[model samples]
Target chain A: MSEILKMAWRNIWRNRRRTLITASSVLFAVFFAIVMRSMQLGTYSNMTANVVGAYTGYAQVQAQGYWDDKTLDNSLDWTPQAEQAVLAHPRVVGLVPRFDSFALAASDSSSKGVGVVGVLPATEDSMSRLSDKLLEGRLPAPTAAEVLVAERLAVFLKIGLGDTLALIGMGYQGISAVGEYPVVGIVRLPSPQLNASLVYTSLENAQELFAAEGRLTSVVLTLDDPDFAEPTCAELAASLPEGLVALPWQELMPELVQQIESDQASGFLILGILYVIVGFGIFGTLLMMLAERRREMGVMMAVGMGRRALATMVGAEMVLLGTLGTLAGMAAAFPMVLYLHHNPILLEGEMAQAMLNLGVEPIVPFALEPGFFVWQGLLVAALVAVASLHPLLSILKLNVINALRA
Target chain B: MNVIEIENLSKEYQTPAAKVRAVDGVSLRFERGEFAAIVGPSGSGKTTLLNLLGGLDQATAGSIRIAGTDLASLRPGQLIDFRKDNIGFVFQSYNLIPVLTALENVEFVMQLQGRPKAERRARAVELLEAVGLGERLDSRPGQLSGGQQQRVAVARALASKPQFVLADEPTANLDSRSALTLLEIMERLNREEGATFIFSTHDPRVVAKARRVIWLEDGKVVSDKTQEPTI
Candidate 1:
């Protein structure tokens, strides 16, 4: 085997130009696949983390039919028991009970429909990262009948901190309710869709305005490990009483998950085509090499080399070429992909607005998982191995006399 | 004992137009340690006979026995083993692997037989020195002259110490002086090493150096002669 390997190594270097050409194809294919996959995975992770962390946390628990109806009638009663049940889970780092209802809010001469989320100020501060997105003023005090409106919503209503706003909407018992509250803060959400129609208030003020003294829409749980969210959610669902459901981020934002999965599939398809091109490039080079060495093969056979040994030597040559190309490509691509993973690329202009409208954050980040790297390397190696089969089969049935004549 | 025996060996190649018989019903025997030459004009079946005897081309009829084993009766793998163990071949064009150095080319056969590195290296060096190519051992085939390349081929042929070495017009590509030198080296190795040497050639210089000569015309051995050394 060592003798065969030495001969194979020599054969590769003998035709320096051909070997380099073959290697370059493998290198370029692997590099392109790694970089493209990294970018796609990065964008997906960034969108999920930023969107979920900024607002929904990793998981949410709502009344079983709340997501489907979203009406005040389906609202879960906000009780101490529900909060305790959610907080008992090991993965639940923080829990916030929210009373969410829609209202027609107006400031002096301007009016708009908005989603009002009534949250416990201190609990929300610890559970969601919304407090950090505040552009002006502060969160309402625990006992104050004050509200926090998104910047875009505030601008549309022409209201500021300390200004009075009227909330007019249907409350529990199918009755219209009206109340007046002061705007305590204005905040900007990462997504434009959220920023344009969201409003926040203290849980007490929400209960008073909606005439629902102890009712709640859902309890949102922030988990320590987002990747285990599905299993944690399943456990929560099992532990909870009937009429309640635990939802992971993926289930909550199914459009986002489907979009990412489709993008990943398309990315791999493109990479597969690139690998086929690389395979053919290597095949062409090996074919030319075999053609040139026909006489040499004949001589080796005449001197007692078996056809199998000759084919084995050629296969070894391809393996060496493939290994070098893959290593070089990985060495060059790993650092670039890792850099992108750490320092995300921010989207701006119309693209940024479009992404924000779709509930995705403006920045795209990469994931530097070892699985992606290993997959790319194996793809290159497999392509080379497949390409080598052509020459190996040809040599197996080679005729020494005809080869010599040629 | 006869080193090589042939009985009614014939080979036919199929063409699009007609069937061509390269060798037809030829019977011959060569004694151990004999330096014999098969002389023929172009297309006279000299190379075909050599190919059949070396187990390189299968004969269409009859059988060939070398060193008491029938070549026609062996399987594909067994034929390869037989060639590796018993037969060595030199070519007219000095078909050395272009990528290999002179020494590596010479050591190739022994490597095929799984010989140890040190032993193969020592034997390769000795053979190269014997062929007067000691100074060119490290040079690739492309770097050597025609005659030097042929000497490397000769050394490679003899490296495995086979019972018989077949030379198919081994000096056809060399100038007269280089041809004489190559023939002299082969003749000396045949005498000193007691290795049987067989040549298929149209070259008179090679024919003159043979201890026995077989002449072929139209795929049949027409004349057989044994020459006495004048010296």
Candidate 2:
């Protein structure tokens, strides 16, 4: 076996130019695959951070029909027992209980419909970092009769700090939910959809206004690790009280998941085409190699070398080529990705504007997921193996007498 | 005792035009330690006959019993092993593995036979010395001259200690001097090692040195005779 391997190694280098060209195809395939996949995943990562991380928590516990209806009647009952049941899971580190409803906000002559979210000030700050996004004044106190209006909503209403804002809507069980309060702060939100008509107040004020005391529209959970969100949500939902479902952000924001999936599918299609091209390149090189070495192979077999052994030697050569290209590609791609990940490439012009409109940052960061390295390497190796089958078939079907004559 | 017994050997090829018989029915026998040459004209089936005897080609209709083992009865893998153990071949082109050095090429067959490394190396060295290539042990086939490459091929063929060695027009590609040198080495090895040697050749010089010569014309044996070899 060692002798065979030695021969195989020497055989590949017999035609140095051809070997390098074939190996180069695999190298570039892996390199482009890694870089492209990293960029795409990084962009998706940024979007996930902006949307799921900042707006929706990793997972949420809500009444079964709440996501579909989002009405006050679909809200869950908030009690010590319910909160304890949610917090019992180890992954669930913190929860921000919210009373979410739509209402008409009017400042003097101006009026607009808005999403009113009543949150526990401290927990909401911890999970959503709402205080970090405060554009003016401060967050509303838990018992204060003041509200925080989104920057865009404040602009639309022509309202500012200490301005009187009136809210009117149907409350729980057909009661007229109406209140007026001072706007204490203006908050900037990342999502344009969320920023357009958002009003935040203390949970107590919301429950009081709605006449639905001790009720919550949802409790957004902050997890220790966001990657485990789906499994944790599944476990939480299985154990939660009837009529309540724990939902991961994927389910909470399915359009984002669908978009990522479609983009990923397209990315894989490009990668598949790349492998096919590289496969043919390798096959072409092997075909030439085999055609030139036909008589040598015949002589070897005529002198007692088995077809199986010759095939193994050829197989080993291709494996070496694949490994060489994969390693070199990873070596070339890793540090580049690492540098870009640390210092992301910021977008400009229409690309930046497009990103901003999508509520995402205008920078692209490479994802250094080890899976990218392993998967790309294995894929190229498998491609090399698949390409080798053509030559192996030729060898198996070789006619020693004819080859020797050739 | 007969080392190779062929009874009614025949080989045919189907062309787009018609069935062409490359080797018509021919019966022959070869004894151990004999220096024999199968002489024929072009397309007279000399090479095909050698290929069939070496297990490199299958006969259309025949039974070839080498050392009492019927060649037709072995499976493909078994035939390969049988060839590894029993047959050695030298092609006219000095078809040494270009990647291997002279010494490594000689050791290659023994390695396939799963001989110990030390023994394979030692025997390869001895064979190279016997073939007067002891000094060029490390030289690759490309680095060697035409005469030197055939010497390496001869050394490689004898390295396996096979029942017989088959040389197909071994002198065809060499100049007269190189051919004469290669024939001298082969004749000496046949005499000293008692290794059976069979050649398919049109060279009269090869026929002159053969202890026995079998002549073929149009795929049929015209004559078989044992004669005293010329020095």
- Candidate 1 local lDDT, A1-406, one digit each (tens): 9878988898899878878877887788878888888888778777777777667777888888888889888887655666777789999888778888999999997999999888888888776666788999998888688888999999999999889989999988787878888888999877787798998988888877888888888777888888888999999887776778899988887877888789888987898899989989888878988999988898788788999999999888888988878888888899988898888888899998888776677777778989988998788778878888878899999997888787
CA lDDT of A162 in candidate 2? 91
* Inter-residue clash pairs, candidate 1: A42-A365, A42-A366, A78-A216
User: Whose lDDT is greatest here?
Assistant: 2
TM-score of each: 0.92, 0.98
What is the C-alpha lDDT profile of model 2 across A74-149, one tens digit per residue?
9998667777888999999888888889899999879999999999888888877899889999999987878999
Candidate 2: tens digits of C-alpha lDDT, residues B1-231: 999999999999999999989889999999999999999999999998999999888999978999999999999889889999888888888999999999999999999999999999999999999888899999999999989999999989899899999999999999988889899999999988788999999998889989999999878899999999885
The TM-score between candidate 2 and the true structure equals 0.98
The 10-residue segment with the lowest total lDDT in model 2 chain B: B84-93
